[model samples]
Target: MSFSSVPFFITFAENPELAICAEDSIKGARLVLKPFKNNLLALFNVDFVQGLFGLATSGNQLVIGAEDITLGAPLALQLLQPESGKLQRWDIFSAPGNIVSAADSCLAFGYRLRTKPPLQLTELNAPPFPQWIFLPFTTTQRGILESAV
Candidate 1:
């Protein structure tokens, strides 16, 4: 089976020595393994106090929003595919006190105040990945989203 068919986790070490070791090992394995490490798993946690609010995706990217009781505003996370020429490591962006919502090809995010003007949603164009080509359309319109790659 290919690496894409398997489940794995990616981690980064903060210590300089550990970081260097991890990088070197990954590089060595990639050199010998050919196209290994070409996929990544994106994991999200929903604390007991925080409940899931929304989910949105653009291409290989995903944004998850949650309502945490401790915070005044919702929390959002943006996950993106790793850049080419590197081990398949994903990127994550976290936003606290941000109102995030999504619909169709649009994504709305930012802070808002009571009685203030509403913020506009940002239009997200199709990404380069084929898996996200039909993301803007409904399941009924585009059929089931599946991949055999």
Candidate 2:
């Protein structure tokens, strides 16, 4: 399965910002994401699961079930735009209700964020990305992903 650069949702009203990233909860990390302005959550590719919250530059699109975990957090997030890339980032932090995923797409767990990201995230180690593959919405996609178990 693949996903497009455009997120499932978009944030146009607030021109969002990156509030925090509580990357210290997930296990077997397979996905990364950021929050935006219009209740949009941006998912990204993660190379590996380093620790509770370790960062990587090489990875694949985050897949649910494959990651094998659930989101465990109430995140305070904002949107971020890198200087040279099409992929957007959501700078998020854990809140009181945050749940970490041992292995699952952040979106599959459940949360709300915006799309209009702030510019502070460019200073981080975010690499350049021209495009991404968003999984198609179909029964086949669901069956294939579900069968991974």
Candidate 3:
């Protein structure tokens, strides 16, 4: 099957060996992914078992987000070395979530809400908002109110 047929997952690697491993892993399961380019392998159609949804390189570690079929729809992050392939997994949440964005030190995740949405921020590890100042005026501050009964 052609890689273009897959949904959406991409991995950029400069190391040829690492890229090969990624391609093998994706294709071994009879999955379609974008053709590897310049030693980079891009995975698409990531809805299959243990399908990869996101990937980011942070310093020497690679952060990966994948669907864990054993746990249902919970998407988890795995930190690993591309060269060594040693990894540790961290569960983010269960209800069909994916890594929406990533930076040098952080990643953003989005989840599907099932019930009435409460007022809450969904971006995980989001940066703090700037503090704002509030000014309140007393009733006596008004000249007409001070002069009236």
Model 2: ten consecutive residues of lowest lDDT = 50-59
- TM-score computed on alpha carbons, candidate 1: 0.17
Q: What is the lDDT of residue 32 in candidate 2?
A: 34
Better of 1 and 3 by lDDT: 3
In Å, residue 58's CA in model 3 sits off its true spot by: 0.8
Q: Which stretches of candidate 2 lie above 4 Å from their native place?
A: 5-15, 19-27, 30-57, 61-149
> Which pairs clash inside model 1?
none
Candidate ranking under lDDT, highest first, comes to 3, 2, 1
Candidate 2 per-residue lDDT, tens place, 1-149, comes to 22332222211222223212223223323233433222112323322222121121112222222111222333222122122111222212322122223222132123233422211112121232111222212312233223233
Q: All candidates: CA RMSD in angstroms?
A: 18.1, 16.3, 23.0
What is candidate 3's local distance difference test score?
0.26
C-alpha TM-score for every candidate = 0.17, 0.20, 0.19
lDDT of 3 by residue, 49-141 (tens): 222333312221233333322211232333443432211132323322323322211323322234221111234444331111111112112
User: How does each model score on lDDT?
Assistant: 0.21, 0.24, 0.26
Report how far off residue 79 is in candidate 1 (Å): 2.1
